[model samples]
Target: MFGFILRRLLSGVVLLFVISTLAYMLLYVGGGNIARRILGQQATAETVAQKTTELGLDRPLLVQYIDWLSHAVTGDFGTSWFTGEMVSSGITSRLGVTLSIVIGATVITAIVAVIIGVWAAVRGGWVDKVVQGVSILGFAIPGFLIALGLVTLFALNLKWFKPTGYVPLTESATGWLATVTLPIIALAIGGIAGVAQQVRGSVVDALQRDYVRTLRSRGLSFNRVVFKHVLRNAGGPALAVLAVQFVGLLGGAVIVERIFAIPGLGQVAVTATSQGDIPMVMGLVVAIAAMVVIINLLIDLLQGWLNPKVRLA
Candidate 1:
């Protein structure tokens, strides 16, 4: 297990390096004349040339990449071209908001998916069909549409939650919940669909195994057999699927954040992209990729713990 974890961590490091390198190249190499964008269209060529030199655009690409990587490793992502603010500070301030939404949605998705999936699997017939149908709808619908529908109902009509705004968790739990509820729901709906389907399918497959029948023959109650034997055996695959969905939710947060006007990493990323803020955009991309890698590693470890066969593999 230790070796497995170490290997996964090393792989994650390699993946981050590759992703950061590609992101850096796309911004610096492909972006062309960033100093012009930063200095505005009115700025003279002499001023632009000076700014380019100051920002080290004249340096060799290899040297620039190494410099950027070294500074990024130290959490010094440099200044935003447009705002002149440090990229690290911009990202750090918004990271909490995105994390809260993603984590809250994930927790909700896990509980709801497991219950609905397991119940549908046990009952089968119409229940199973309904769950599958919901899963298809989740895959088909866009998250922003769901956000708009939710806001129209919960915010516009009912006035229960705010339509758009963000409140820090440090301020008030109630206020935070009120602010984030719609965004969480928007994010969770599709995830619940995807995860519940995986769970349902896994549980259904687990139920048909000879061991399940053997447990029933030994006079174990149906619920006990299903929960203890079936779920434990089936849960490994569902956990893997859930982890994938969680990573996807981080990316999806971008659209949801924009729709709801929430100031988060997603919002920051979009703004940075529009303004050609390479440092800020690279910071956001690397942060999201690192998060995805960490979550996937944890998932693999959990799966191995649950299934010894996985550990051996």
Candidate 2:
């Protein structure tokens, strides 16, 4: 298991390096005059040349990449061209706001998924049908549409919550939660439905396994057999999907961020792309790619632990 985990970690590091190198080359070597664009067209050629030298745009590609990588390793994520503020510090400052929403939404979605999944599996009949219908709807409906509908219903029509903007959770936890509540729900709906559908399918399959039948024959209660044994065994595949979903959700916050006007990494990424703030955009891209690779590695290690066959492989 330790060997398997170590191997996955190594692979994750390699993947992150590859992603970062590609981003660097595209932004710097691919005809993107980083400093020139940042300085705007109105700036004189002399000023542009000086600014490029200051920003080290004149440095060789290899030197620039090495410097960028070294700085990234040491936690210096460069400054935002638009705001002229340290990018790393800006991200750190907004970390609380983004994390609150992501973590809260993730937890709520997972809990809801588990409950609905287990209930649907155990109950079957009409309950299962309803769950299936909802999951289908979740898969079909776009997130932006959900956000718009939520704003119209709760904010415009009923006045139950604020329609736009974010409030710091530290300042007022209740207000922060209330303000971001709809966004969280909007984000969570698809996750909950997806997880529930996967869990229900896994549970159904696990319940009919030979080992499960044997456990039942051994006088184990139905609930014990299903909850303890089946849930854990089925978790192997279900967890893999869930991990992917979690990572995807963290990066895919762009749509949700835009609709809700939440200033997060996703929002920063979008703005950076629009203005061609290559460094900021590249930083976010690296962050996202690293996050995804790390999550996948963790999932592999978890699967290896849960299923010994995976460890051997």
lDDT of 1 by residue, 128-216 (tens): 89888988998789998999999999999999998998988889989999999999999999999999999998999998999999999
Cα lDDT, all candidates: 0.91, 0.81
Worst 10 residues of 1 by lDDT: 24-33
TM-score of 2: 0.91
Regions of model 2 farther than 4 Å from truth:
29-31, 297-305
Cα error, residue 49 of model 2, in Å, equals: 2.7
Give residue 161's error in model 1 in angstroms.
0.9
Q: Quick one: best TM-score, which candidate? A: 1
Residue 303's lDDT in candidate 2 = 77
